[model samples]
Target: DTAVSQTPKYLVTQMGNDKSIKCEQNLGHDTMYWYKQDSKKFLKIMFSYNNKELIINETVPNRFSPKSPDKAHLNLHINSLELGDSAVYFCASSQQGSETQYFGPGTRLLVL
Candidate 1:
């Protein structure tokens, strides 16, 4: 069984557009997170939610929003996309009080 999954492995869009990527987990984890890896291969945390409660917020733009329907699902919505937004978005999940995490394949976003 897949522990974590994200939709639309590849995405291409023009500037000023809006898009969304969905994530789901089946590992019965309580904490889900969104991470962005830039072209330089630097990983940074965008947001994290545990039990549907917002817990971590990094230096992300206002146009980016993270929504969690439940503990097993976390989705990201991006608006007014810009070239700077082009990056690999990864979804991850972890158990409560656990340091280990499982990551999804990742969604590649390209703003043309």
Candidate 2:
């Protein structure tokens, strides 16, 4: 079984459109994170949730929002998407204090 999973593995949409990606973890982890990998393959953390509480939030635009309904799910909502938002969005989860993170198959987004 997959430890982490994301919906809509590929997304293609026009600029200014709104989209959302859903993430879930079956590893029973306490912490979950959202990461974005740009075309250059630079991966950066966008947000982190621990036990359903927002812990770490990076300097991403206000258009990007992370919502966690529980400890096992973290969903990302992007509004007014721009070309710059075209990237691979990855969802990961790990134990609260562990360094190991299980990542889901990335959601490739294309904003034209």
Candidate 3:
């Protein structure tokens, strides 16, 4: 069974469009995170949630939002998407206090 999963593994949209990526983890981890990898392949964490509470908020545009409905789920919603938003978004989960994380197959987003 997949420990972590994301919907719409691929997405293509125009600039100014709104999009959302959904993530779920079956690992029973208490912490979940959203990371983005740009075309340059630099990975950075955008948001982190622990026990359904926001824990870390990286310096990202306000257009980006992370929502956690429960411990096992974290979703990313982007508003007014721009060309810079084209990248691979990854969802990961780990136990509290653990550095190890299990990542879902990334969602590739392309904004033209």
Q: Model-by-model lDDT, in order?
A: 0.96, 0.97, 0.96
Q: Estimated TM-score per prediction?
A: 0.98, 0.98, 0.98
Model 2 over residues 9-51: C-alpha lDDT tens digits?
Answer: 9999999999999999999999999999999999999999999
RMSD of each: 0.5, 0.5, 0.5
- Write one digit per residue (lDDT tens) for candidate 1, span 76-103: 9999999999999999999989999999
Model 3 agreement with the true structure over 1-112: per-residue lDDT tens digits: 9999999899999999999999999998999999999999998999999999999999999999889999999999999999999999999999998999999999999999
Which of 2 and 3 is ahead in lDDT?
A: 2
- Per-residue lDDT value at 93 in model 1: 97
Off by over 4 Å in 3: none
RMSD of 3: 0.5
List pairs with backbone clashes in candidate 1. Answer: none
Error of 3 at 36 (Å): 0.4
- The list of candidate 1 runs beyond 4 A from truth reads none
Clashes of each: 0, 0, 0
